[model samples]
Target chain A: MVQALIGIGIVYIGILIVLSLRSRREIKSSTDFILGGAKIGLILGFMTFAATLFSTFTLMGMPDFSRTHGVGAWLFLAFSDAVMVFFILWFGFYLRKRIGQQSFRGMSSLLQDCYQNKGVGYLYFTAAFLFLIPYVAIQIRGVAIFLLEAFPDFISVGFWSVLIVLIMLLYSELGGLKAIIYADFMQGTLLLIVVWLVAFNCLDQVGGWASLFEKINESNRALLSPPGPKGLLTPQFLIASCIAIAMIPVTQPQLSTRLVIMKNYKSLLRMAVAVGTFAMLIILPTIIIGLYGALYYAEESTSGFLGTVLLQEQHPIVAAVTIIGLFAAAMSTSDSQLFAMGNEFRGLLGASKEDQLTPVRVAIIVFAIAALLFSLVSSDELVLLARLSFSGTGIMGPMIILGILSKKPMGSFMIWFSALALLIFILSQLNVVPQNIYSFRVDLALMILLSLGAFINYRLKK
Target chain B: MIKNWSERKLKSTWRIIYWSAILLIAVTFSPIVLIQDKVDPHWLQMPFHLWVSILNTIVLVALTGVGGYVFYTLKSKTDNDQNL
Candidate 1:
């Protein structure tokens, strides 16, 4: 197994290096580097989009989530993803029509232009920075801890985290967004294949789907229903989660940038459908794998369960591929996010495109280091932490949507209003404020308020 | 005159599909689909709630495909009319 892991790991890194070096030659300008020349076709666009959206969280976090939370985890992610892809069809059209293909620098810059205010741009960049760093951190942290468990006699978790960050920065800095997209294509394919392979094996071991569920029913019937044993998947929580997840493409820079960079509307639409299909296919298998854990490794720690199911229980070659797949998942997401932040920072600059690349590259390095540091200190509750990141960025969704959709010169009220909402959400996360107000989650309440405020502001300005 | 009328009809139909997709999403999250402890009426040996939610997701994705088709048709027609 160790030999297989070493062989496969070398091959994977070899591919990444080759792809990055090859992509580096194609960069003629900052736009080409930052936006994949803004001409991504259907297949590339779909792969990158799915890869960025589903990551370490999908592979490592989700199985444990389902094992603990039950089938309702499906609604929390897969169903929400279904709704989100449909939304991309609607929102992507309007956004592309407004921004055009070539003129888009980043969402921050676009918002600055729309509101004719720098504060909006600052607000957007700050919010993305605050939320996305933790997200990237968890990806690094997830893979690092898993590696530690796999190679218990290997390097420390912090060293593994730094190594991952360094590799990510090296490739992304060399080839830019194009390199990241190519890497994403490879990562997304591996993620799907590896997940389904493990799931099929688990299912077969459990004597197929019928017997699997029958065993689950006998062991813990709550696994079959909503609000499982822990009672966490309530209606309000699921609804809020859906809203947050749906808002992802609207507010998350990595995904929204994908929408803007597609070759055309047709490709974008096709990519949206493909992603929805991918979401269902990828998530279905995790349920089987999770249920397998529920029956066998139910009382085990997260790392223990994952190490056994994803590695020890598998063939040597399969386990090697799983390790590489997990690494791919983490890097696929972290690099795009780091790149997107750099692009957003570029968008806020007053410098020329030529001058912008230097600062942008510097910012990417800085952001990757911050994520590496955060990963060392971050918690193991991957799914909930990921949801917080989604909900946090989602606070800006209404503000972003209004800026894109409204024709009038909307005033700066929403900029400040969104800033306040973001502050409150952060405070709630830190326990400085209650997470719920009058039995409504503060994040949901803030989303409602921001949406309403944006609507009224639009009407008054018009 | 015929083009104008058909384009307007297409626009309206697109709007209907758009709203229906939204409505379907809302319904899926409601109590009807997410009913707790209602594990009967199993499909493919899966529980009631799980299968219903899965079916709803498939339906939603299908609706998105339909919506995308209608939107492209409406958009192309409008673009053609403008070109003329």
Candidate 2:
């Protein structure tokens, strides 16, 4: 198993290095570096988008989510993703029409131009930085912890996390966004194959699909329904989660940039459908794995269950591929996010495109280091932390949407309102403010308020 | 005039599909689909809500494809008109 892991790991790294060097040659300008020359075709576009959207969170976090929370976990992620892809269709069209093909720097820079206010850009950058760093951290931490537990004698979590970050930084710094996209294409394909293979083995062990659910029913019937045994997936939670997940393409720079860099609307449309299909296919297997865990390792720790199912119980070669796939999934997401942050920072700068690449590269390294530090201290509750990141960034959705959809010069009020909402959302996360107000989650309420605010602002401006 | 009318009709059809997808998503989370304590009507031994939601998701993805086609038709027509 160790030899297999070493062999596969070397091959994976070799591919990433080759992709990076190839991409480096293509980086003739900052546009090429930052936006992959803004000419991504349907297949690469969909693959990169799916890879970034589904991460270690999908592989590690989600099966555990279903194991603990139950089938409503489906609604929590997969259904929300279905809705999100549809949203990409609508929002991507308008956004592309608004920004045109050439001039979109990043969401923050676009917002600055729309509102003619630097504060909006700063607000966007702050929200993304505050939320995305933790997200990237969890990806690093998730893989690091899993590695530590799987090979208890191998290395410390700190070493694994640092090594992952360094590899990601080197890869992204070498190849830029084009390199990242190519890497994502490889990672996404590997993730789907590995997840389904593990799921197939787990299902076979549990006596296939029908028997799997039957065993789950015998263990905990609540695992088959809404709210589960722990009562976490309530209607409000699902709805708020749905809205937050749906807002991802709008609020998250990593995804929204994918929308912009597609070769054309035809490519974007095809990619959206492909991503929706990929979301369904990828998430379908996690349910089986989760149900398997619910029946067998119900009392085990997350790392214990994952290590047992992903490594101890699988074929050695399969386990090796799973490890490499997990690494790819983690890097696929972390690098895009770190690079997107750099892109957003570059957007806010007043420098020339050539001058901006150096600082942008510097910012990517800085963000990667910050994520590495955060990963060391962050908790292993991967899905909830991920949801928090989504909800945190989703607060900026209406502000971004209004900027994209409205043609006229928008007032500054929505910008400030969004900023305040973001602060309150952050405070709520810290328990400085209650997470719910009068039976409504604060994030949901803030999203509603900001949406209304944007609508009214548009009307008044018109 | 015929082209304008046809484009308008295509635009309205696209809007309908888009809003219908939104409505389906909203209803999927409501009590209609998320009924707790009711796992009887199982398909392939999967629970009621789980299979139902799965089917719903499939429909939604299909709707996105349909919606995209309609949108493409509308967009292409408008582009053609502008070019003319």
Candidate 3:
């Protein structure tokens, strides 16, 4: 197992290094580095978008969620993903048209242009930094913990966490967004293949589909039903999750940037549909593995269940490749987000265009270090943490919609409202405030308030 | 027929497509489609919630394809008008 893991890791790193080196040659200006000269085409666009959106969270978090939450996990992600992809189609068109008129930069810069205020830009960047860093950190922490379980006593989990961050920073600094996209292509492909392979093994272990569900039903009938055994997938939770996740392309910088950089609107539309299809295909396996876990490893620790199902039960070479795939999943997602953080900060900085690149790179490194520290100190439930990032960032969705849809500058009031909403959201997540109001999550309430505020504010303005 | 429509007409059509698509998406996942509690009448032996989720995916995919087709046709017509 050790030998196979080392071998696959070296090969994976080699491919990543080569892709970054090639990407380095494409770096002519900050535009080229950040948006790949805004000329990315259909295939690369879809793959990168899919890759960035689905990550270690999909690979590690989804199965566990499915195992614990029951069938409602499907509605939590796969259904929400379907909704988000359609939103991508609608938003991508508007974003493509707007970006064509104005040059491309980070989402923060675009919001700044829309609101005609530097403060709006800073507010957007601050929200991203606050929520996305923990998101990026948890991605590292998730795979690192899995890696430690796979190779116990060899190195601490923190070391593995730092190692992945270092890998992300090295390639991102060298090649920029293009490098990250290229890495995403690799990661996305490996994830699809590896997840399906693991799912097949799990299915075989449980004696196939019918048997798997039967075993789960026999153990806990709720696992075979809605809201699962934990009852975490209520209607409100599903609706709220759909709202939070569907806004991702509008609110998340990394994904929003991809929408603008596509070669044309046709490609963007195609990518949207392709991503929806990919979401369905990719999540199918996680359900299988989750069911397998529900049947066999229901009470086992997450590490124990994942360790056995992912590694110990699989062939050594397959186990090694799965490890590499998880690392790829983590790196691909983290690099895009970490790099977006850099771009977001760069937009906030009033530096000269020529001097901006270095500062952004430095900011990315600082964010990476902060994420590494957080990874060491913090461990939490992956799906909820990921959803927190989504919901936190989703608060900015109305602001982004206003920016994309309207030609005129928005009121600074919307910016302030969004920042306040983000604060309340973070507080709720931290348990500083109760997490729900009238059976709806706090983030859902904030989403409603922000959306209403955006609508009324704009309507009153006109 | 859409090809002969005015630009404003075409724009209105696109707007309709966009909102209707959004509505379709919402309905598929929302409680309106199927409540979660009932477990009878399994399709292919899959549970009610699970089948509904799968059905939602397929329905969404079809809606997206239809939406894409409308937009593509309209876009091409508009592009042709620009060239002429």
Per-candidate TM-scores read 0.97, 0.97, 0.94
lDDT for residue A228 in candidate 3, whole number 0-100: 65
Per residue, candidate 1 scores C-alpha lDDT tens digits across B32-57 of 88787778888999998788888888
Q: Which run of 10 residues does model 1 chain B get worst, by summed lDDT?
A: B75-84
Any residue pairs clashing in model 2, and if so which?
Answer: none
lDDT of 3: 0.82
Over A181-284, each residue of candidate 1 has an lDDT whose tens digit, in order, gives 99999999999999999999999999999998889889999988888889999888888899999999988999999998888888888899999999999999
Order of the predicted models by DockQ, top scorer first: 2, 1, 3
Q: What RMSD does each model have against the real structure?
A: 2.1, 2.0, 2.5
Model 2 per-residue lDDT at A157: 94
**What docking class should model 3 receive?**
acceptable
The clash count of every prediction, one per candidate, is 0, 0, 0
Q: Give candidate 2's error at residue A311 in angstroms.
A: 0.7
Whole-model lDDT per candidate: 0.89, 0.90, 0.82
Model 3's chain A TM-score stands at 0.97
